[model samples]
Target: MTDVRLAERPELPDRLPLPVVDNHCHLDIRRDDAPEVALRQVISEAASVGVDRLVQIGCDIGSARWTAAVVDEHPALLGGVAIHPNEVPRHEAAGDLDDVLDEIASLAQHPRIRVIGETGLDYYRTGPDGVAVQQESFRRHIALAKRLGLALQIHDRDAHDDVLRILVEEGAPERTVLHCYSGDMEMARECVRRGYYLSFAGTVTFRSAKDLRDALSVTPMEHLLVETDAPYLTPTPHRGRANAPYLVPHTVRAMAATLNTSVPQLCQALSDNSEHVYGPWS
Candidate 1:
């Protein structure tokens, strides 16, 4: 959680030598710093620092609608829609799961909707009781991706093993992305071997994320992607502040340092991978 009292947003990073796409973000999220940072402002601020393209995620019903509509208006934004795993229990308990999944399926048909996700398992938040529905939901989302011929973006939390197991069980879509990947070296190797893309977020820049960096070490650049997962995992130096698309350069710089590669080289790779996974922003 960001310290809202620190109303000061960080200054823009020195622009990247090459522009890179923010593979995962939630511009619709309302944080205290700027409850709803104007969409125009979000795009402009990010562009000012070479973060020109953004893949906005709308993981719930309302935001999914917002995403479907908004993506049509912004050439810089491509979108993904899903019912997040943590949100699974609430709908299942209310018996609204079927209805919402129907809605997601319909909304996903929008021309600008390019991905089905921010889905998958998250054991850290939901306990054993919710596991069944979460797994069911994940399977459905994976099926939707394959049926629609769209990419899938996963949100695996403390549920890496189960996540991997289910992904293999369901037969993952061609361009599956483990968004904000937090798995270990061995799991990283396995995921890469299975041809999954691992997207590193601001969390990778943390001092305690040595394992996360190690995972990145083995993830080939072609399978590498960068993201903000914004209004959340704000990178180091800007940790306590509300995150946004503009802060992506910080994470990009950190990733380059960890990979022991030039910033330009990594930026080009991230940019290339984003397009490869989600297709062109245009």
Candidate 2:
């Protein structure tokens, strides 16, 4: 059974005229009791709506392993592996931080793993005490991504300056993405100037996200990406629901509206950007 606290599953939106990619999702964290069944349903439903593929993100050790395996079995998926910022404190305390990161570094070698990410700063939940370890982990992940020649997906939250500083200091990977980009217009321009990709999530569709929409307006289509970050950040009208990849059309449609373009136009741009960052899914 799905969690009762979450909003009910939403009806599917109309199929997109062109295919788009969900640049970030967590298939392993579906609310359904039978995850395998849920995963298949979401993927199939997403395809029917022209969301042809997903970049499954694994921001923890177990999910990283799961993501690595799941992508091998599913033609519609690629993988992103890392330890999340909040998890940094726990792992460091366990005294196996390096070991797990080494394991993640090994997992980066997997053919289906195309990204190292969701691995940047987050000061909102983590305190000042944990910032050093988090920064250390972030730097190492940046290095690992560069070493493996994979795209870097960052999870910046309330630590934008530090995140950008470290990226410049350590030298960001060739392909760097600010996943669920929460920065304002100036920050957006800075990211664009630095040639970093900004991936917007469902939050961008919310009425409360005026700043995000402003950032989107200035972002070039080629540098913009979209994601579900599913089971969280469910887009408007379905804002409180248990999100899935199938629901991406709603967000994409809203994004098109915000950019004052047709859905297909935005879809094509998003598809092109996804492929540019992660290479071909096919």
Candidate 3:
């Protein structure tokens, strides 16, 4: 079940003509509330903003099930399964990963399970001791996604080179995505050149994120996606408030400005990119 605080229903506009997609969120982590109630709240909030589809991430075994359940309830929601880097040690020590991976693999066969991650390196959060475990887990998930022909959603933080090196070396699936891409302009260009999708979040809307804006400006429209990363990184006008999928438009607006395009155009491009990565959820 989702947390009440994270799943509050949002007020949508009366007429929502634009098309949008929340490419990343943790519907499975909604603060300790009933799953049904949380899902209803999320659906209502997203629908209000004309968001036709959402790809919710399950960063662990339990959340993976929750994500699948939510997708079952809300046809517009999709699921991705993997153990987040921070959670790898616990999963390994508990001897719970095999069951988790087996369950996730089985769940990936579902039509709504479109991707196999939100998984990758996070050196900033975990020190050197966690490196081996993180890498082993990352490679395992990558191998699974490759074998299953599923999209791989990566979560890289301050470990761009290692992540890229591993992906390149292992020949990651063609439909890989870098969620909340926080790398420099050069890395962004390299990722685009290598045919990876770059999904931006609310951080793009911050006043001091000139580098990120510059990176967005240079990235091609076909390889770009936008997300809220909700219950976190809320965009302007609601910077301090808890974020939800409904706030995607603010990030979309900021992306459009950065790319020197109209909101409709940006939305169209992002929706197209999303469909390419996760297949058409709608």
Best-performing candidate as measured by TM-score:
1
Q: Which TM-score value belongs to model 3?
A: 0.91
Report the number of clashing residue pairs per model: 0, 0, 3
Model 2, residue 189: distance off in Å is: 0.5
* Candidate 3 global CA lDDT score: 0.83
Candidate 1 has a TM-score of: 0.97
Ranking the candidates on TM-score from highest down gives 1, 2, 3
Per-residue CA lDDT of model 3 for 24-140, tens digit only, reads 988655433423346677777777787778899988878888887778777788889888988887777788867777887887787788899989999988888889989888898
Lowest lDDT 10-mer window, candidate 1?
A: 1-10
Highest-lDDT candidate = 1
* Model 1 / residue 155 / CA error / Å: 0.7
* TM-score on alpha carbons, each prediction: 0.97, 0.96, 0.91
Off by over 4 Å in 3: 1-17, 31-37
Candidate 1 RMSD to the correct structure = 1.5
In terms of lDDT, model 2 sits at 0.91
Residue pairs in clash, model 2? none
lDDT by residue for model 1 over 95-139, one digit each (tens)? 999999999999999888999998999999899999999999999
Clashing pairs in 3: 2-30, 3-30, 3-31
